[model samples]
Target: MSEASKHKAYAQRDGLNHVALVCDDLSSTEDRVPKYFEIYSHADYELGKRFYFHDDDGTEYEMVC
Candidate 1:
């Protein structure tokens, strides 16, 4: 099959939703990582303040607020 023919459109472009980077210190992680996009969504859970942020590269991350 040709490369163009094998390519999937936006609707069919299936891939990873996001990557979870575990950190011992949430504060440090936020401080070091520059936010590419505004918080997509956040919530308070048993783990702590969960903040979901998206990047320009179509990647998302979850960190503590």
Candidate 2:
């Protein structure tokens, strides 16, 4: 198994609440993310929106605006 899969549940249990990567342009980032990752959820807040994704190994990530 991949290292990312090993920590999949751990990350969820710990409630990791930070952006893993920050991009200058979210639209550009969003366009490229699906090529490598699977987007599972998305939410729009007062400030902006967030896109949640996971890799093949089940590692999770969040992109926020």
Top candidate on lDDT is: 2
lDDT of 2: 0.67
Tens-place lDDT per residue, model 1, 1-65, is: 64223321122215665566666777666655654455545467886875556567656667754
Instruction: List candidate 1 segments past 4 Å from native.
Output: 1-13, 35-41
* Candidate 1 lDDT (Cα, 0 to 1): 0.55
TM-score of each: 0.50, 0.59
Which 10 consecutive residues of model 2 have the lowest summed lDDT? Answer: 4-13
Which of the numbered candidates is closest to the native, going by highest TM-score?
2
List pairs with backbone clashes in candidate 1.
Answer: none
| Model 1 TM | 0.50
